[model samples]
Target: MDLDLAAVRAFVAVADDRYFGDAAAGLGISQQAVSKRVAKLEADLGTALLRRTPNGAEPTEDGASFLVQARALIALADQAVDLVRSRHRALRVGVLGTRIASAETVRAFHETVPDVGVEMLRSEGLADALTALARGTIDAFFGRALGDLGGIEARPVYLEPVHVLVGRGHPFAALDGVPIADLAGRSLWVPGAVRPETEWADFYRVLAAEFGVRVDTTGPNFGVDDLVERTAASPELITGVGEKIRVPWHRGVVQIPVVEPSPCYPWSLLWHPRNRHPVLPELVAFTREGFRPYRPGRDWIPEPDRPAFTA
Candidate 1:
């Protein structure tokens, strides 16, 4: 049934002031208007909310009970309005891989959304982040779009060419860019812990297949430093990393570009279309303004062609 908030407000005002004229004055309306609104409320509720007293008016038994609920409703409404207007416009976003961000992007986000308090949630991989997004655990996600995102809305933020991390003393370290074919005889180490699902692992596996390379996976407890330390210790093992990521300069670890049909990692912002966060669109807009068309080099394609599924 349709409940009129205006009538409820009028009834609450009458109940508070105990007089139609006083209630009308408080509401800045005529006494006749206040009486009509209260009557309408009573008619709709099928109960008498107020009764005429000798001096002015008084609430009936039912009106006294509903008076509390009416004030509570108005209080809740006020709270909601205050929440939207105050600094509580917070957004929870999932960030994948290393949590490193460019200085410019950070500055832009703060400038564009000065009032929005952003809470960055970390996940191990894109699939995990996207899962959090789908489950309503996060308002948005920042990372590579693994494959077909069935229900999520994705927007590309930047395109980063994949880089190979190798030991400084390795044979490929002297080269400017390692060709994809050069990985044929090399072993690529990937972290196996908490990756959300097999799709991400499958993408790398497909890359290994298309280029005739050996894909090796490690433990269920691997981390960023662990992967780097392991790669630095083994000259025969190398790993893939995003060029934009700022890995701490290890004594023996070096990062090199991967070229010859260079596999580009496309970073995107993913959000559910029905998200309720008021600041989510503002954040997405801020991110888009920062990266607009971020393809740093030549031979830029929208996505990686090797994975086949991501294309």
Candidate 2:
């Protein structure tokens, strides 16, 4: 008998949720549709897969064993689709912002595998970047690696220092650079709870506590323009940003390097482990072999030998 892939997916969903209604919700289909699909699968296999309980549906003895096989089949099906689609000559890489410092990497990748088309997809933060990778919207991404990357593989690229963004002509802007400790009593504008998609908020908060940088947590979805304007208006208010971040010249803002215990931001390249694109492995290998880790300059001060920011 022919086992349907759709029915297998429905069965796995139901098994995972332990309820037809919840599984249908997840699949974005009706409860009856999911029930019918699962029923058809059970009939084809000649087994009663699920038994209804007061709480939800429970898999039977046979179903518990078959679940393992069902998940494996689904994984294989996904891999097959990925492999076939990759043959069309395209690879998309995800970036957090317009300035992700990935130009060198992308150029190197193209030089190594010149035939495959390379495209860039911009995402808001690390979470969105990973989500896009999982959905196959992008083949890989360059960003800070969080602790839990799920099934994705993270390879460290380098460590970037955080720069202090102060309005031009401000008291702190007169000097060449300022120490990280100088931000002890100033207000640093940061995206708070309102901007739920901003993944680097916690990192800033931790840096503030560590180096005595006073951060203003009260804000509602501030963008690059908002940050520049706010800091230009109030000299006392400042912000920390990645060293590679490109801050447009507004004649009101100046990016100053934070010295004497500079905050280090670790960046990594992330890709789904099972992505079957032919050039994917080649691109990863190129970076893994030749990519250089960040080293501080002679004048740079250590972070009191502090830990690196994971996020």
Candidate 3:
């Protein structure tokens, strides 16, 4: 038979206080209302749950047996509510990779609010991260928001300066900084830029087209270790990396700044409008407070990402 939780709660309260007037005061309800709820509960069970005594109301033998299960039911129900409410759950954030600048930003945010737990999930790229955000698998994402954003809301967070990685014998290795024009006619080997539709690939494509830098996507795309080893072995081959990216250390490889209007990779924090995570606003506030504005004359941003940086 179906049972009303309200009536059950009223019965438990009445049993605890052992008096209808006392139970009504505890429940913030009238004595008559409490009595009616207990009466209804006893009738539904087809047994006397409580019996009036000279001192007060005492639970019957049947009421004593059912009290344990009723309390358990209330405890389980409260736990379920807390779970759905995300009372103490960690905030899940999607980042492109741990070695990139976005991951560092998330780390800094966590450090700022140490009490707020954070879970960092690595994503393939902006497209992958955005899909996770839309699916509600991730609370927020950190990446460049280009093309159609649809219902996604974004805020510019950081602009990481671009750097060139070259072998010791390479011509640019000895220089303090390589100008953007100097990269022309030079091939930038990016193993992960094979997908033309991905956000990172698209950014490099535009960088190649605008600056006359050729992006060579060679076969057998390996991880960063292979990329670092191969780049260090070849004197002529060069690759572009973000200044903040933590690449594997190689004695033969040197990282030099790409200056004279530095090319910057734009980073934005993206989240769905429907996401109601309490810590989300705190993260947004942290990013806003620490944001370093893009220098229009000194920094070079891609055309697609220009609006966000400019705005």
Q: Model 2: runs farther than 4 Å from truth?
A: 1-81, 102-115, 192-199, 289-311
Inter-residue clash pairs, candidate 1: none
Off by over 4 Å in 1: 1-87, 98-108, 111-115, 124-131, 146-150, 192-199, 290-311
**Residue 31 alpha-carbon offset, candidate 2, angstroms:** 24
Residue-level lDDT of model 3, residues 1-311, one tens digit each, is 98888788888898899889999999899999998988898899999999899989888899999999988887788767755776467889998788889889889999989998999998877778778878768888998888777788999999999898999999999999999999898898887888888888888898899899999987777777888899899989888888999999999999999988898989999999877778989988988887887788799888777777774
Highest-TM-score candidate? 3
Candidate 1 lDDT (Cα, 0 to 1): 0.72
As a whole number from 0 to 100, the lDDT of residue 83 in candidate 2 is 74
Please write out the lDDT profile of model 1 over residues 1-311, one tens digit for every residue.
Answer: 77788888899888888888899999999999988898898999999988998877788899889989999998888767755653355677776543355323444586766766876766766667667877767778776666678789877676567788898778988999988878886777666522436545656666676678676676654566777887799777788776777677788898999887676655677899877677887878877765534333443343353232232
Give the better candidate number (1 or 3) by lDDT. 3
The lDDT per prediction is 0.72, 0.74, 0.87
Alpha-carbon deviation at 134 in model 3, angstroms: 2.1
TM-score to true structure, per model: 0.61, 0.64, 0.73
- lDDT by residue for model 2 over 22-64, one digit each (tens)? 9999999999999999999999999998999998998899999
